[model samples]
Structure formats: structure tokens, C-alpha cells
Target: MNGSDQTERPDGTAAILSTIGEVAYRWTREGDRLEWGGDALALFGIASAEAIATGHAFDTLLDDASPLARHDSLLIGADHGGGVPYQIEYALRPSGPRGPVLWIEDTGRWYADGGETARRAEGVMRVINERHAREQRLAFLSGYDDVTGLYNRSALLDILDQTICDAKERDVNAAFLLVAIDDFRLINDAYGYRAGDRVLAAVARRIRGRLRDGDIMGRFSGHKLGLVLMGCDENEMAFAAERFLAAVRDDVVATADGTVSITISVGGVAVPHDAGNREEAMERVQESLGVARDSGRGRFVGYSPSPERDAQRQTNITLSQQLIGALSEQRLRLAFQPVVDIHSRETVFHESLLRLAQPDGSIASAGQIVPLAERLGLSRLFDLAVLDRVLETLARHPDARLSLNVAPETAAGADWLAKFAKTVSQRPDIGSRLIVEITETSAIRNLDETAYFVSTVHDLGARLAIDDFGAGFTSFRNLRALRIDMVKIDGSFIATLPTSPDDQIFVRRLVELAQDLGIETVAEWVQDEETVALLSSWGVNRIQGHLSGAATLSPPWK
Candidate 1:
């Protein structure tokens, strides 16, 4: 008898395979005999080892009907005196002629040395099982959050997409609720990160308890939960939002520091009503969330798309695409508006305004076009384009000075600052000739960042101005903290300064405040000589508007 005919392994092959729950068997290629070295026969419901060894039971044990099963020849290089080891896996046919099939991984090899064969099979099977378990773990982690045990953001998005498709096919409604915990950052700030985590887990549990089994919910991001409700309209969604809000509003979450009661702001949007697609639905819900948070804490708002809002959204979408093309295709044109000395009436400098010329021979003003760029995160592109032109013009005329408007988003970014600094540093003269303007609203939004920008501008030999002064809640404390060169007073007060006594008082006080701080003031929208004279009397240093001159393509200094 050859080595394949051996029924038992005297070598150490049996010990290794037995430890890891693997069974071993041997087959003779010539006689077509199969024999088990361990309890492998019982796995296939064979009556005994004799039943397999006596007949050609190899074919009967295999499920040839299964498309996935492999029954290829086990004899590879077996015709010669020696052959390399090969393994095959197949499905087991029903035992009682009515049972379900079971897949069996049969890793075996022809053995000149049966001990080496068993050792190799044991090693391969162990690796296969470990790899299978590792893959399952990875798959689970990818789809589910480890902390809350909920579907993660990416998985939830897929679910939302599928739900949207299902709703479209069935002509039903779907709504998504965005739940945000109010003052969540304060919790993390006061207590440690551990306490914040406790609050988050508690909130998730409370919200999850209230959701129906059919509905789906997940942690959308930090301090926010997304809930998907099927067959819900705006009214029904409002009720659902109330329920979700009730879950977190009244309960006090016990943390390490103490107990804290939290409130949630919820915003929902209905599909095929408020929006047409998933992206639009998400945008509408986000807007609703903003409205809810802005209203107050512990509030719920359902998105109602007004005709004007819808039209504006459409226009923004169209203009965003156009803005991208404008930046890439160099279609942006610059218009110069002078900010002259209020007393001298001489061109002090030109403020570069951007204009986008459409393919239809229509020009869009910076006011109408730049906001779309800011929203789409292309403000830096627009800013850099204007900067390049300003640099070129300044290079040609050594005496020229240009003030350019920097979008709040662009100024807040480090990348833009680095590039801007590098370009200005190369020519120290450019800094004195350049004036960087940031809006009052933008300055107040992130005062520290804006102050740093001011310092950097001063270092680069450029001047910084707080544009649209008095437009927002401008604290004098922060205003004085910034080392600025100019303050362009907001145009609203100047528009009615001549007629409105109340405006006259506000303008007078504003100019006095700026002078007291030793900051130069430029009064904007000086439409007539009367308004200009009033501003000049109030000690305004400069004036900008139609009175100075309308923004024109031609350079005023020329």
C-alpha cells in the first residue's frame, strides 16, 4: 500500500489538525479510494469509514449541482512518479435526500510523506479561518459606529439614497430630521472629553429608544444625529420631531462632573416637496437647522421652500457653475472705483471691483456674483485673480496704490495668507501700494484671526482697513485692538445722512469714535455734495460713491 492508502497518521500530522477542529482524510488517485484519518467521516454523515473506502463515494459526497462547487480533477501532475500537492473545496450534497447543502473546505494534498501533508493542511486552514474572521470584523467596523452601535455617516448616506429611490418609485414622501444638541461644545469645554462622550451616548440612546423599528437613525457627525422617516409629510415630520426632541429635552444626563439637562434643535425636510434630490434635500434640511438654531435652543423647524428662496437657490446653483468657469477661463474683468480724499477730491487710490461678463453679453456685478463664489468656496480663487491683476498694474505705475476686497472666507484661511505674504514679500514696495480690506462683519466673526491678518498685513508693508464699518455689532474694544489703516463706513447711514437727522447723529458719533481711536475714516455712498460736505465737516478723511465717481473700467489716475 502506498502512502495515500494509509488510514492513520503515525507522524505528528494528526496532532496539529486535531487541535484546531480540522479533520483529515486521504485519497488514492489510482484506486479511487477515500479514507479518513480522524472523525472526518461523521461530518459528511457517512455511516462508517468502510462505506467511503468500499465504493466510489467521492462523487456522491460532492454537490455537483452547486455552481460555486469545484469538482476539478484532484490529480495535478499525478500521472508522473511525483506530483505537487493540490487542494479543492466543494459543497456537500443533502444527506437524507431532503436536507440543505453545506459548503466544506477540503484542503488536502497527495503525500509521499503523510506527516508533512497534514502539517501543511493545518497551517493553510488556520490562515484561511483567521483571514475570514479579520475580513468580517473590518466589514462590520466600516458599516457601524463602534461607540453608539449605529450605522455610520457613510452607511447612513447609502440608506438615505436608497430610501429616496424607493420613495420616487412608490410616489410617497420621505423626511430627514437633523438633531443637534445645543451647547454641546460647552459640555466638552467644562467637563473633559469623557464627559462629552457620556452625554453623546446618552442622547443617542434616548433618541434611538423613541424611533420606530422601521425608521432609521444614525450619528451624522459630531453632536448631530440624522433620522430617516418614511411615509412622513411635513406635518407628520413635525410631530416626529417633537417626539425626538422630547427624548432629550426633559432628561438630565449624569456626567462625571454633575448632572446636565440638554436640549436639541431639530430640522426636517420633506422630499418631492421641499427638494428634488438627496443633495437638495440635505441642503434644505441644513438651512432649516440653521433657522432652528437661530430661533433659539430647543426649537424645531420644518423647511418650507418659498418661491423666492427656490428661485435664489436655482440662481446660486447656476451661478456657482458659471463662477467656476469664470475663474478657470479667465473671464473675470476688473472695474476701478476711486476712494478720493474728502478734502482734496483727488484720486487717493482705486478699489478694484470684480465683474463677471456672461457669454450672452451681460455683465454681472461683484455684489451679485461674488457671494456665490464665497458660498462655493471659490472666494480664494477670485481673490487671487484680483491680486494678480493688482500686482501687474502696480508694477507698471510705481506711484499707484490699489485697495482690494478680500472675502471673509479667503482671509480666514492660512493657504491664502501664505501665498499672499509670499507674493507681497518679494516686492516690499507692493505692500505700501496695496491696501487689504476686510468687512466689519467678517472682522467681528473671528476677531483673533482678523487681528492676526492685520498684523501680517502691516508686516508686509500693506495697510488693512475694516470695510463696511458699523454694518454689524462692532465692539469698540476689538476695533481698538486691531492696528488698522482705514475704516470704510457702511453706506446705509450715508445714504440718508443728508435727510435723516438720526442718520446725521449716528454718522457724527461714528466719525468722532474713529478719530478718537486715531483711525482714518472713509464715508461711502456720498451721493451728493450735501452728503459729502456733511461727511467732511464730520472730519471724514475720504469719500467713495457716485459722488466720487462710479466704478469704471478705465483707471481714474489716468
Candidate 2:
């Protein structure tokens, strides 16, 4: 028989054009529906031949709105002679048991007609689709918020500027509203940036729901966002902002640790209605934000567009800078909190705390320095300075196994991690004795990255502890995944640990959970002996509170 006439199924289970090639067959049934053979179905994860014959093949290949179904042109080959032919790539997304993708090369017409038939029927998978997918991912990483899936500050401004310029030329009115989360940082401080980011993501979703079709919103800064209301009037703008605020108020962001309550403070300016330029509009909204913060948190302050408010904004900026400068120049000092191991009734370690040393020879708590530092955008720097004090004290005593308090914002910073690694590198000996106490919210900022860092620290002989557990939604997934060495029950939880049966039950369960994971449990703010006894009974491995003593050094730690 001639080569084509040698009717053969070399493999009894299936057939291919060439004995060496993959399975290929065409079946027509169910009103001209076409079904591919085993090779194509297998690429999509189909296990058996009988499965494809049962209309599964039809269910897998075509989608509801497939353009392929509507197009009338025959699948054709290029005008290539019988030499090695070139082929363009295509992707096949399956909708059934096989999984998402399969690629088939259509190399047929090369031999069917005289060489002029073109190389139309060639089957070879190319990397084009994969390459395009990678580019899309890159674009998202560079322009989007990983948590919220919205545009970040950099991407937001670029889009805003383009929209604004286009609107100006077209004589269109586009309003810009700046929404700052009221007490959002407090949530972060109380919870962790990881949990805080979840809240932001939830808030972003709410804003998107409230926006118009042409309008866009982006996260402008940590806890601050911007919305562009295109083709809107003063009244529409008002309605949208109110709509956004109302939506946010309705949200309850849950983290693995706990549920966090939050609210937003917004300031808006209807461009062309209130200001002539972007800078003026942004400044006016900023002033309005200042008004919102000053009046009381959790409310909206509409832009008034006046000189007095602008002046006040400038003054605040100046004061913030001065405060930052003072701290940077040896104006911050160290205080120590003696945390006793409740069961042992002995001081195991003193938590290295921060104090802003004033020129008046008075020291203020870190709680005082944080707001100013944040306003100055120097929170990371302040956190590092605190680390320095902690490290320096360890250098003095060398025997103290101390845990250091950390702020959420600082933990999320690349610079902080870089410096943290450097500090450890400089004093390798200190690594074993240090307990880095990070709040659940802070550690959760970027969970995977933070977990890797935690693992790295553990490798370096440093311990990782989650501070303020039960204050936010932190999960056992993270607890298990990260392998944290310690869990600090939030002081609020400890404060009511005995009085509230729910609290006692939760703490006991938490302690047992930590034990199962080989993580120690620490109770914070244990004020009295009764609380200490309760914590001890609950299996708290350590305790730190006022009863142990206020954080101090020589001079009342003040």
C-alpha cells in the first residue's frame, strides 16, 4: 500500500497522522460539533479516552462568546514550498476536566497542495502568549497595589495628570477627591500592616462600587486615596464622596487575627468649580483634610479654598520637620521595660523602649514621637533609632534576652529591612539574644515576604514574635506558615482575661495553639497578681506589665 493508503492505528488505544506523532482524530456529531482526539484532550488533563466521547470534548473546547465560532474563514496555510514551514502560535483554553490550556500546531497544507499552498497547517507551540502574560504581570506589579488590586500612588498620579490635562483641553470638568482613613494607622498599630492592608483593600472595593463608569480611584498613600470623578458636577461629586464614605462605614475588614473597625475622612475639590490647577486643587483638599483631622476623626471635610488653611498646613509641615530633625540628632533616648516571666516571678528581659529626649532634659514616650515622625515621613528613621537603642543596651548587658517593640509602618519598609540586616551583620553575636516583637498587623503587611524574612531571622538565630495577637484578624495559616517563636496576647485581651470568660477561653485556646506550634505565649499589660495568676494558669510562658514595672532606666525610665 502507498504511505497514505497504509491504514494503520499503530497504538490500539488511539491514532496519529505519523506513528511517532501524538493522537489526532476528528469526530463530527451533535449538529456539526467537532471533537479533537486524545492528545488534545490529554493536554487539558483528561485521563481516559471514553471520557472525551461523552460530549466532554464539546463542553471543553468552545466558550459561550468564542469569536472562533462566528468567524467564517477556513483555517489556512501560508504560501510556502515543502521546506520547513513557519507557524504563528495560538492558545487553547479548555473549559472542562482538562485544565486551562492546550496548544495544537496546524501543519497540514504544506503537502496537500503544490508548494504554493503555504505552510498553513503547522502545529508548534510558541512562547508568545506566555511572554504577553509575563508582561501583564510586570505591568501590574509596577502600577498596582498588591493587596487592593488598585493603582498605587505612582500609577494614580500618572493617570490623574493625563485625565486632568485631557479634561482641561476638552473643557470638561473632572473632580479630585482625597480620602484619608480616619484612625486607620491606629488600626494598623493595634493590628499589623498585614491586617491593615486587608482593610485598605476592602475600602478600595467599597470606593470602586461607589464610583461612576468613567471615574477612577487609586491609593494615593498609606491610608490616603484619591478619586477622579470625570464628567461630574458639584452635586454628583458630593453624592459620590458621600456614597464612598457610606460604603466604607458599612465594611468590616476581617484579618486572620480578628475583625478591625475603621472609618474614612475625605476632602474633595471639584476642579474648574473650585480651583484652576491640579496643585491648587490638591492643596485645597489637603487643607480640608487638616480640618477633618482637627475637628475629630471619622468625618468628611470639604475644601473651602482659602489662604488661612493653607498657611496652617505649611506650619504643621514645618513643625513636623523640626520634630524629626531633633530626634535624628541624639534627641531620642532609651527606656527599658522589665518583663517578668510570670511563672518564675523573675525578670527574664527588659523590652527596649523609646523616649524622645528633650533639650529641657525631659524624656517623652514613643507614643509622643510617632505622630510627628509619621507627619514628617520619618517613621522608618525613628524606628531604626529605636532599634539602635535596643541593640546598644544589649551590647551593655550582653546577657539580657530582650524583645524590642516595632511599629507597623517601619516593618513594611525596604529600608528598614536593609538596615535591620546590616545591624545584625555588624553584631552577629547579638542575633541569638534578640526577640523582634512585631505586631500582628505589621508582620502581616506583606505576608509571604515577611514570612521569608522571619525565616531568615530564625536562620540568623533571632526570634520572631507576634505582638498584640487577638487585636486583629491573624490566622493559624500565618502562624503555622511563618513558624513564629512567640505570640504576645494583646494587653486589652489580657486586661479582661480573667473577668471575661470568653477572653479566658480564647487565651487558653491560644496558649494551647501556640504550644502545639512550639511557640511561646506572652501576656502583656498584666497589672496585678490576679491577672498574673490567671495568665500563668492559662500557660502564658512569659508576662510583661505595670505590675512588673514601668519601663525605666535609673530615673524612673521617664
Candidate 3:
């Protein structure tokens, strides 16, 4: 048969299409005629071929609101004249009109031959419906909470800002209330997270029920709700907050495990009257909330903007901005402190330390600026910058080994480690000479990631050390699980080791523990020769403190 005959006669198409699990069908553009054949009818769960051939209109079969329906005209585009095939997938209502929806992948071509009527037809097959459902779920999750079906933090913030702006421009009044469940952690601790979730959902329902018309309410964050009340003055705001507080006073949430009773602390602020912008307004409201929670649990307080509070927040903002600028400009300096082998009295390595250079030529230690950088989400950036500097410094001193402190977040995550591994892979010479020290708290808090990090660094020919070992619990557990190379004793324990018998016993036992695990022990805060002698007697392998040398700005070995 010629191409035109093949297009017109799809009687044998069902057998051919069924081999590939598709359905065959034909349609005409002029008359909008549709014909169903092959396994396509069976895939769509339509048993009545007569009804499909007689009553089903092409337009009605397409979902009215779908993009497929909007693009129906494109199916018969320029490809028709060249006899080029085209394809589009869309949802099609089933034959019975009351059955389930079926996704159809339709392929069609227009046929024209001398002395024969031109016709357009397409074949369609079943497709997995997950694609459509996934798109819908993503759209829903963008604005609404998956757990409680309330607006999420981002959506709430947008609405709150718009409400505040409208209040400013139109000279209207509004109030924002931030309600937090008091001691929510207690519930989570007693029960599991699932039970805690049930309690939170119950609280959300109660708060939502208390909201009046023209008011917007949403889940702001963990165990917190933000409510925007239209036309609410100071007095009305107080009453509304009290009403919301009273709603959950006697209500007990019933979970599968047991019942949970909860109370809330609320902070309210009059928009535009309490503060000008969203950030300022949120700060004032949060401060009021803090006051309420601090005064007593389950209490409500209204915001009173204070110049002192605003000034303090402004100062923090300025400092954070300056820190960002300094980091970008690479205005950070490194100080090196020597770690000496106790038995040999040989400086084995220098620990790299961080210092921030101020605009006025003075330097600020990492302790003074790193916490602020972390709070402002610059920790990773700062961490990467430190790595870059360490690499450069190491390249300069090829014969010397350097130990660098890693931020908890950067040390415990795969992203930073991947970058570190790639850099070391490029310059294999520095791998054996670099020692990464993770603080005790960071390692124990995220043990799994820490284990991964340890394996990765070891594979890259670098050594891993636990800094401030005795400062937290799980030191022994971490040593047993992680293949550590060294353990640095916290300075506080070492400060009194030469004088205090209790400290001597503790350090002795710690040293024995490290020796048993095949890990070297380094004693910090070695202040005197007596302390050094005591550390050596206890079998500590290395010592790091002022007794050996202060943290010098430049590495002497380099």
C-alpha cells in the first residue's frame, strides 16, 4: 500500500502497535472525525468502540484546563505539507465518561493523494500518570505546608509584607501576631516526632479556626504561626491574640501514642505603627515574643518599638555586612601554633589558625568574627576561603605539615569534602602533609557524616584528628567508630593536670585509651616544664601550648 493508503487503513495497525504496547487511532482535521483502533481503546479502559466512533468529540476528549488542549492547533502545523509526523502527549477522558483519566501519547500525520480525500489521524498509548501528579504536587508544596495544609513560611512572609505595605500606603491599620507553642521540645522528647507533628497540626487547626474574615494565618516555622489581621488597632489586636490563646487552652490533641496538652505565647505588633519595614516589624515582634516567654510561659505581649533595640540590631547588621566584605576581599590572616612531639621535643606540625584583619590595620581572632559569619550563612564561604588559603600556604612550605580547623557544617557535609578531595587530587603532594581537625561537638552531633568525612580524607592521604576531645560526650564512641589519627585533649583538662590528682587520673586514662585505639594523643595548654614532664609521663605523644611557642603570624618552618 502507498503512504496515503497506509494512513487511511489502520485495520492492521492495532496488531503492529500492540507489539510495542501502544494504541492506534486516526482522525480528520476537516470534519474533526476520530477513529479508535489497536490496543489504545483497551489501554484507556474503554470497551465500547461504538460509542468512541460515534459520540466522542475530539475537543471534548482533551482535558479543558490542560496545556494539551491549548496547543491543539499546533498538532497540524507546517509538518502537514511535508508529510512529517508530529507527536504530543496529553490526558484523555475515558470512553465510559465516568471512568479514570488516562494519559495518551498521540502521534499523527496528515495524508493527501491525487483524487483522494485528505485525512489526519493519530495513534495514542497509555503513559504513567506520575508526571502530571508530580507537577501538581510541586506546585502545591511551593506555597502550602505538606504536614498541616497551611501556608508555608515563604508564602506567609510575602503576604505579611504586602499587607504591611498596603497598610502604609492606604492609611489602614493591621496587626501581626507571632504565636509559638511553649516548650514544644518537651512534647517531642516525651513522644516521637510523629506525635509531636500531631500536636502541632492540632494547634494549627485551633489557630486557623480563631482567625476572622479578611485575616490571613499560616505556619511560619517550627511550632510557630504568623497571623495578619486586617483593620485591627491596638485594642483589637490584644483581643484577637487572647482569643487565639484561649482556643487551645483546654484542647488536648489525641495522638496514636497518647494525648498532649499545649499552651502558646504570643507577640503582636501593629503594622506601620510599630515598625516601618518587614524586617524591622519581625524583629520587634520577635523581641516582644521573647519578653512574653521570658516573663512567664503562655503569656501574650504587644510590641513597643525601642530605639535601643533597633540600634543594637542595626549594629549587628553593619558588622555582618563588614565581615562579608572582608571575606570577599581575602582580608583574613593565618596564625600558626607549633605542635611538638613530647618524647623528641621536635615540632612535628603547625596548626593553622584564623585571624580577621580590620580596616584599621588591627586583627580580630576567628572567635570574635566567625560566629557572626556563621549566623549570617557565610560559614561555608568562609570555610572554603580558609581552605584556599591553607592550600596556598602549604604549596609555599612543601616540607612542613599544617593542621587546619574546619567549621562543623563544612566538616560534616559532602559538598565541602568533595571540593577538598578534588583539590587534593590535583595536588597530591599536599595530601599527606595536611591534617584536618574537627571539634568534638561537631563530630558527635553528626556522627554519620563525620564517619564519611574521615574515610574520604584518609583515602585522600590526609590525617583526621578530633580537637577538644574531652569537651563533650561520645569521645570514646567516636574513637571506636572513626579511624582517627590523633586526639587533642581539651585545654581545660590539661590546665590543672600537673597539680590536680583528679586531672592526672583523667589524662592518664585518656592517654591509655588513645594508645589502645592506636591513635596519638596531643595535650593542649602545656604551660610549664612540669606540665610537659607530666604529659610525657602519661604517654601523651604531642604537646601544643604557649610553653612550646605562641601562635606566630608566620610559620617558622616555612
Candidate 4:
């Protein structure tokens, strides 16, 4: 087709195609001649259609890194009978220095001659700049935090894992720093969440600016950043931490709310030296950060291995392994403790406590196993195992009512609730007969999330209780918000209830408040009849202690 026949059609099809950012093209392989239709000059931002008249001239506009070229796509393929169809996405270089690079989706068919050599091709090219830009944005967000524009936690952990591997293979020292902005919550509370976010972004920028070229930085969590310093030993790590601390501390971040001075506490660990794996690295760095914060805010603490701490870690590791083995071997058991009415001394519901049997005929109680399980990230397994056993017990004993305590982590997560919902769906009768207890401390940690958890458990037809109630000193508003079925007063107050008048007053007031809110009160660790009498006089609903019965392996129903 000639230039006028290509660009000027009487039917106005060329005008319609150009409006939609599409252009038609034809190529003759013999003389490398190219022809374009539908306002090709405007669509491609070229001075004239003649600029791309030849195939060689058209190829000059393609990006150097583009995956495919026209000749490669048409000539490299096997010969077909009629025509071979193909589609490719590629970038086109700008015609001028100020022109924008365009992304094009080229789709067409190539025809072959009798000799099986490709000779001619015809195709339509559509601009896909918007779609390509959206895809590129999504790709960037996958590995980055939008707030700080830094690598996110997942990406940071992946890089840290590789760094650990490199340290072991190359025998090169590196350091991982877990940095937290000290008193960040104060900023959020005094200003607003938006101001707090501004501070976080500012702190991230400051820390990133101080890092070496080979180092990597990322947002590890809210108000915290993770940094990996290559070829850094303990001394160097400490020095690096100091530099970061000063970078944040010396500046006042300007936010929409106001200017706020910020300081950061850092915890550093020499990788493959103090920490051999990702988990160990994270754990040690967090421990050091905690120490730094505990000593004083805005300080740097480097991990130093100690015999006692090492021994404790080793013991924990051994215990975790044994616990895993015990769980697999079905040696994990539950002990039942009856929560009885204070006045009637009759059983209300039994609290199911976790127990693990040892090969030497001894048993490990929940107190021994739970904290360690939570620390070692085994609480989810324990929670699920306990839940299965509890469900089975409820199924077998129709008249038995049971309450079970879930770890703080489980209380904050959805997995336990999902399992409970599934089981209750299968055995509808068990839901009303079961109670889930979350510690008061855990409930107060994030009142909003705990309230949602309470609401979900109630919707699933199960009762929810706040365990160790007085320990958290939960506000009346939060207590009402949770809408729990019962509050078990912390054992510490009840342990010395009879002798301590202060404890007596506290217990009486707590019981009165719970009663006023229509929430049941259970006094734990009631040892003597005098204490029980006091609790009964105070109108405590239930009592669980040695006076009633210690948690026993033998099932009460059996």
C-alpha cells in the first residue's frame, strides 16, 4: 500500500484506530521496506512516517533491552502452512531526548514463501503505557513498604536469610541491627497516627542515609527498622549503631502536626557469630533491643554471649525439641481442675490445663511449658493440640463443661478461632458447653483486637473469660467493651486474701464491679476455708484452688 492508501481511508477507519492509540504496519523482508497506517507519526511521536519506512529503521526505535525484535520473532520460527500468529510486548525508545518511552503490544501474523523463508508480515501495535506502569508499580510494592518506601519485613527477612548463609559459606562477619524509635507511642498519643507515621518515615530516611553502600535496610515492624551490615564484626556493629542513633537523635522531624525530636534504640548482633540462622538472628537482636530499652531509651546494646544465657538457650532448645517429639508421639496430656461455686461447693465447669508426660514417669505442667512454647513459636501447635483434645473430651462427655486457656499469641491470632469454629460446626452441642480464656494482660495489650476476638468467640456460640483479671488492672470501659462471661481474679491477690486486708478490699471491690457489670467473678488460689468464706461473703461466683481440687491427670468424668 502507498502512504495515502495506508493513512487516508474513505471509511475513516484510520481516524478511529488512531483515536484508540493503535497503528497498523506492513513489512517486506526482501528489501526491508516498512509501511504504516492510521496516523503512525502521531502515535509513535515521530517527525514523519518516512522515519520508520524501512524495517532496519523501525528496529532502531526499539529499546536495547527489549525481549523481542520483529525479525527475530518472524524469521526464527518454524515454517507454517498459511501463517504463524505471534504477540509480543516491548518498549520503544523515545524519538527525542524529551520524548517519553512508549510500551507497545504488537500482535500480528507472518506469511512464508514456498522456500519456507518468512518474507512478509502485517500487524497492529497498541500502546500499553498505562497498563505497563500499573504492573511496574505493583511489582515495586511487593518488595517495599509504601509508608517509608523501604524494603518490607518479608523482603528484609529474605535478605537476612541469604546474608546468614553467606556468612557461613564465606566466613565473613556481618551484623544485624534491630532498631526501634524510643517513646514512639508518646508521639502517636500526643500528636496523631499520621504524625507518628511521618516520624517513622523520617527516622527510616535518617538511618538509611547513614548506612554503607553494601548495607541493606528495611521496615521490620511498626516504629522499628532492620539493618544488615556486611563484613561488620561486633565492634564495627556497635560503631554503626552509634552512627544510626545519632542520625535519628540529632534531627527534629517536621510533621504536619508539628516538629518532634526523635531518638532510636538499637540492638545489634554479629551474624553467624552470635546468631547462626534467621530465627536466632531475629531473637538475639530483639533481646538486645529489649536490653537497650530497659537500661535506658535511645541507647545501643550489642549482643554478647554469656554462659548463663547460652545455657538457658540450650535448655530451651532441648525442651522445644522434646516438646515437639512429645506432641508427635501423643504424649501431651491435659489435666482438669474443677471451678466450683463458692457457696454450694459444687462444680460449675472444669478448667483444662496442659500437661506433658516424661519417660521417667514425671509430668510437666502448663506453667513449665507454656512460656517456653510461646518463646519458641510453638504456642500455635500447642493451642491446636489442646483444642483437638478438648473437643474430643467434650464430644465424649456430654454433661462435662470445660474452660481452656490459650496462649497470648493464639488469643491475638485467628487460627485458634478458625479451628474452634470448624469443630463447633461439626459438633454444635460443644460450643455452648465450652469456654475460651484469654489472660487479662493479653486482652489489654490490644483492647480493640481482643474485643473483636471476644465478639467472634461469642458469635461462634462459645463463652469467653478474662483470666488473671486483676493483674492487668483493666479499665471499666475496656472491661465492658470486651463483654466477657467471667473474670478470674489473679492468684496473687487470692493467695494471701485471708491475711492481707488490702487484698480483701481489692478482691471485694473487684467482685462488686464484676457483679455490677453482670460479669461472673472467679477467685483463684483460694487455699483455706477462711479465704473461701471471705470470697463467698464477697459474692464471688466460683473458686478454683487446692481447696476445691488440684488439676489432675485423671478425668473427673471417668
Q: Which candidate is the best by TM-score?
A: 1
Candidates sorted on lDDT, descending: 4, 3, 1, 2
The 10-residue segment of model 4 with minimum total lDDT is 1-10
Cα TM-score per model: 0.71, 0.51, 0.66, 0.70
For residues 1-558, could you state the per-residue lDDT of candidate 1 as single tens digits?
122333446785655665665656545444655555544544455555555562255566556653332324443343232435666544556364466565555565543334322221111221243454576679987998766778888988788888888888899988988989999999989887788878888888999888886899887888888889988988899889998889888778876677898999999998766777779878888899999999999999999868997798788788778788877888888898989998889989989999988888788899887776778778888998888888878877788889999998888877767876787777778889889999988998887899888888888888999888888858777888987778999999999888999989988998898899999999888899999889888899999999888998776554
TM-score winner, 1 or 4: 1
Worst 10 residues of 1 by lDDT: 118-127
lDDT (10s digit) by residue, model 3, range 1-558: 111122323467656766666656666655455565555455656555443553134445665444544125434444434554667666767653555676666566655422244455454554657776887799999999888888998998899899989999999999889999999999989997887788888888888888888898888889888888999977788899889889988777787878878899999889888877889778888888989999888899999767896798788889878988998788988889999999788899999888999999999997787788777767877888888888888778788789998888888667778877887888898889999999888888877888988999999899999998888856576687988899999999999877799888888888998899899999998899999888887789999999888897866862
Clashing pairs in 1: none
Return the lDDT, model 4, position 70.
Answer: 54
Tell me each candidate's RMSD, in Å, in order: 8.3, 14.8, 8.7, 6.0
For residues 1-558, what per-residue lDDT tens digits would candidate 4 score against the true structure? Answer: 443345656777667777888987788887888877787777787776566888777777887667546568555575567777888888888575345789989898888865577788888888999999999999988999989999999999999999999999999999999999999999999999998999899888888889889999999999899999999999898789989988988878887899998888999999999999999999999999999999997899999888998899899889889889999999889999999998889999999999999889899999898888888999989999999999999999999999999877888888889989998999999999999999988999888889888999998888999999898898877888888889999999999888899998988999999999999999899899999888888888999999999999899996
Give the runs in model 2 whose Cα sits over 4 Å from its true position.
1-273, 282-315, 371-376, 555-558
Which candidate number would show the highest lDDT if scored against the true structure?
4
What value does the lDDT take at residue 197 in candidate 4?
90
* Cα deviation of 390, candidate 4, in Å: 4.9
Which segments of candidate 1 are over 4 A away from where they belong?
1-137, 161-176, 192-194, 230-235, 269-291, 302-311, 326-329, 357-378, 496-500, 527-538, 546-550
